[model samples]
Structures are given as C-alpha cells and as structure tokens.
Target: MRILGIDPGYAIVGFGALDYTRNTFTTLQYGAITTKAHTTFEDRLSEIYDDMTQLLAAVKPDAMAIETLFYTTNQKTVIAVAEARGVLLLCARQAGVPVFEYTPLQVKQSVSGYGKATKKQVQEMTRTLLKLPAVPKPDDTADALAMAICHAYSYRSKQYGVALTKRQQMGYF
Candidate 1:
C-alpha cells in the first residue's frame, strides 16, 4: 500500500509518502510545502490546495494519514491549522484516497510503543524504520514520516491481529 502522511499547517505543510508491504517500508518522498509570510491568507490557502492537488496526482497514494488537530493556547493559530487540515481532508476525499486520522499520542504509541514517547524518540524511530541514515530535516518532515509509520502499523494491527504493546492493546481501536 502507498500511504501519504500530512502535517497540515498554513506556513509549512509537511508531507511524507511511503510504500508498505509485508511489514517493510520504502520511503518515496518527504518534504514540506512552505508559504511566504508576506502572502495573503487566501493566497496561502490557495497555494496549499494547489500543491496538495498536484502532490496527490503525482504520488497516487492508496491511503492518506493525517494528524488530528490539537488544541493550543493561540486560538488564531489553531483555527488556521484547522482550516488547512480541512483542505487536506477534502483533497483526500475528492482524490478517492482512504483517509485515517491519528492523534499525536496515538502516533507516538503506534510507532514507538509508548503513548508518551518524546518527540526525539519518535523521530529516531521513524528514521530507523525507514532505514534512513539521518532523520529528515525540518522537524515537520520527520513528524510526517512518523505519521506514516503510525498508519502502517495501525493497518497491520487490524489486518493481521498484530499485537501492540500492553498499553496500546488496551484502547487502540
């Protein structure tokens, strides 16, 4: 299966594409879609939508995994991220890609075997899983890769009854 993972943000939307099969992963691409600060908000959204549309067409993923929005102290930032996330979801649906959402905690647990794993731990694991010599740059890119790993594991857990850690086995579904 080819999975595309997205870390949606108005300033920089991170993405990672991976192909999973028989418990192995092949990293296809990992990068970020950056919008200039000087651009109007509407133009920023347009840039995101256009870039995402082209990316979907190029990658042709079988599924898409995205991080759910987490509440933040800054309402403005939260709302903007939510809007970007909405566009991502819409694009996925329109492109006919199956979309799955996971929280940060779920992603950490799915990839690192602990719900509270540190960001560094998750990034390291993501790098190791992809057999990359180094963690992908621009933290958001690494986060996107971790998201993909989370989805891959989640799918495997369901399809093969693969065992998660005791903590994860409790309420993962």
Candidate 2:
C-alpha cells in the first residue's frame, strides 16, 4: 500500500510518502510545501491546494494519513491550522484517497511504543524505521514520516484481525 502523510500548516505543509509491503517500508518522498509570509492568506491557501493536488497526482497513494488538530491555547492558531487541514482533506477526497486521521499520542505510540514519547524519540524512531542515516530535516517533515509509519503499522494490524481498542481504532493512543 502506498500511503501519504500530511502535517498541514498555512506557512509550511509537510508531506511524506511511503510504500508498505510485506512488512517493509520504502520511503518514496518527504518534503514541505512552504508559503511566503508576504503572500496573502487566500493566496497561501491556494498555493497549498495546488501543491497538494500535484502531490496527489504524483504519488497516487491508496490511503492518506493526517494529523488530527489539537489545540493547546491559541484559538486563532487553531483556526488557521484547521483551515489548512480542510484544504488538505479536500485534495485527498478529490483524489479518491481514503483519509485516516491520527493524533499526536497515537503517532508517538505507534512509532516509539510509548504514548508519552518525546518529539525527539518519535523522530529518532521514524528515522530508524525508515533506515535513514539521520533524522529528516525540519521537524515537520519528520512528523509527517511518523504519521505514515503510524498508519502503516495500524493498517497491518487491522489486516491481521488484531482487535485494537476503540482508542487505537480511532487513532488515539
């Protein structure tokens, strides 16, 4: 299965693509779609939509995994991220890809076997799982890769009829 993972943001939308087969992963690509600060918000969103459309066309992934929105305190920031995520999801839906959402805790648990794993731990585990010499640059890029790994692991378990808990089924650790 080919899976595309996205970490959506207006300024920087990170993406990672992977092919999973026979219990192995092949990293296809990993990068970020960056928008300039000088650009208008509408223009930035358009750019993101266009880039995501092209990425979907290029990767042709069977499934897409995205990080679910989690807000700490800033309502304005949360709303912006939510808008970005909406565009990302629209692109995936238009491309006929099944989208699965995962939380930060779920991603950490899937990648590091610990729900409370630190960001560094998740990044290191993602690098190790992909057999990379070093962690991917730009923390968002690594986070995207971790999202892909989480989906791959969860999908594999589901295919084997492993009865994951409701929280796990809902992509929460």
Candidate 3:
C-alpha cells in the first residue's frame, strides 16, 4: 500500500509518501508545502489547497494518515491550522482515499515504542527504522513520516481478533 502522511499547518503543511508491503516500508517522497507569511490568509489557504491537490495527483496514495489537531494556548494559530487541516481532509475525501487520524502521543508510541518519547527520540527512531542516513529535516517532514509509520502499525492492531484467527490461518494479516 502507498500511504501519504500529513502534518497540516497554514504556513507549512508537511507531507510524506511511503510504500508498505510485507511489514516493511519504503520512503517514496517527503517534503512540505509552504505558503509565504506575507500573503493574505485566504490566499495562503488557496495556495495550500492547490499544493495539496498537486501532491495527491503526484503521489496517488491508497490511503492517508493525518495527525489530529490538539488544543493550544494560541487560539489564532489553532484556528488557522484547523482550516488548513480541513483542506487536507477534504482533498483526501474527494480522492477516495481512506483517512486515519492519530494523535501525537499515538504517533510517538508507534514510532518509538514509548508513548512519552521525546521529540528527539521519536525523530531518531524514525530515522533508524526507515534506515535513513539522517532524520528528515524541517521537523514537520520527519513528523509526517512518523505518521505513516504509525498507520503501518495500526493495521496490526486492527487485524487482531478471534474471527481474524481463522482468516489468518488461511494466510492473512
């Protein structure tokens, strides 16, 4: 499966594409869609939508995993990020990609095997797991990749059941 992971923000929406098969991951692409601070807010949103549309076209992911928004002290920033996230979710929905939302703590746990892992620890584990020479830069990009890894692990949790045991006996999971 090809999965696109997103860390949404108006100023910089980070993205990563990875191919998962047989319990392994292959990083296809990772980058960010950035809007200029000087641009009007509406224009920034437009830019984000356009860039995200182009990214979906190029990546053609089977599914998308996104980090869910959490409350923050800065209401303005929260609102802006939420708007950007809406665009991200809409693009995925329109493209017929199944969406999965994970919290930051879940991502940390899946990527680092520790729910309380530090940001640096998560980044380092992501780098090591993907066998990258170094962690992806711009923080957000690394975060996006971590989201992808989280989904890969989530599939494991989803497949566990007594009913699935018969299916697995026939070769599944």
Candidate 4:
C-alpha cells in the first residue's frame, strides 16, 4: 500500500509518501508545499490546491492520512489551517484516494507507543522506526511521516482482521 501523510497548513503543507508491504515501510518521498507569505490569502489557497493536485497525481497514493483539527489558542491560525486541510481532503477525494484522519495523540501513540509522548520523542521514534539517518527537517515534515507510519500500523491491524475496541473505532473517527 502506498500512503501519503499530510500536515496541513496555509503557509506550508508537509507531505510524506511511504510504501507499506508485509509489515515493512519504505519511504518514497517527503517534502512541503510552501506558499509565499507576501501572496494574497486567496492566491495562497489557489497555490495549495494546484500544488496538492499535482502531488496527488504524482504520488498516486492508495490512502491519505491527515491529522484532524485540534483546538488552538490562535483562532486565525486554526481557521487557516482548517481551510488548508479542506483543500487537501478535496484533492484526495478527487484523486480517489481513501482518507484517514488521526488525532495528534493517536499519531503519537502509534509512532512512539505512548499517547503522551513529547514532540521530540515522537520524532526520534519515527526516525528510529523508519531507520532514517536523522529526523526529517522542518518539524511538520517529521509529523507528516509519523502520520504515515500511524496509518500503516492502523491499516495493518485491520488487514489481519483484528477486532477494534470502541476506543479504537473512535480513533478512526
């Protein structure tokens, strides 16, 4: 299975692509789609949509794993990120890629075996799991890879016909 993980943002959308097979993960690509700060908000969104459309076509992922929106102190930032996420979802739907949403806690637990793991812990664990020489740069990129790893693990559980508990089902939600 090919999975694309996304860390959505209006300024920079991070993405990582991975191929999972027989319980193994191989990194295919990882990067960010950045929009200039000087650009108009509408233009930034248009850039995101265009870049995401190209990414979806290039990666051709079977599934897209994205972090769900979480409460933040900055309402404007949150709203902007939400809009970016919406564009990502739209692109995935248009590309016929199944989308999976994971909370930050779920992603941490999946990647680091602990829901309360710190950001550095999760990044370190993600690096260890993927056998990367170093943690991916631009924190969002690392987060994106973690999201991909999370989905691979979650999907594997389902692939083997494992029964999910109520809480696990809620994780999918």
**Candidate of highest lDDT:** 2
What tens-digit string does per-residue lDDT give for candidate 4 at 1-173?
89999999999898999998755789999989999999998899999999999999999999999999997899999998998899889999999999999999999989999999999999999899888999998889999999999999888676655776665545433
Q: TM-score for all predictions?
A: 0.91, 0.92, 0.92, 0.91
Q: Please identify which of the two predictions, 1 or 2, would achieve the higher lDDT against the true structure.
A: 2
Q: Please give the clash total of every predicted structure, in order.
A: 0, 0, 0, 0
Model 2: per-residue Cα lDDT over 1-173, one tens digit each: 89998888999988999998766789999999999999998999999999999999999999999999998799998998899999999999999999999999999999999999999999999999999989987888999999999999987676656876666555455
Model 2, 7: alpha-carbon shift in Å? 0.9
lDDT of 1: 0.91
Tens-digit lDDT track of model 3 for 114-163? 99999999999989988899999889999999999998778556756534
Better of 3 and 4 by TM-score: 3
Q: Once superposed on the true structure, which residue ranges of model 4 sit more than 4 Å away at CA?
A: 163-173
- Model 1 agreement with the true structure over 39-107: per-residue lDDT tens digits: 999899989999999999999999999999999799999999999889888888889999999999999
Between prediction 2 and prediction 4, which has the larger lDDT?
2
After superposition, the stretches of candidate 1 with alpha carbons farther than 4 Å from their true spots are 160-173
The per-model lDDT (C-alpha) reads: 0.91, 0.92, 0.89, 0.91
Candidate 2 wrong stretches, greater than 4 Å: 163-173
Q: Measured by TM-score, how close is model 3 to the native structure?
A: 0.92
Worst 10 residues of 3 by lDDT: 162-171
**Better candidate number, 1 or 3, judged by TM-score:** 3
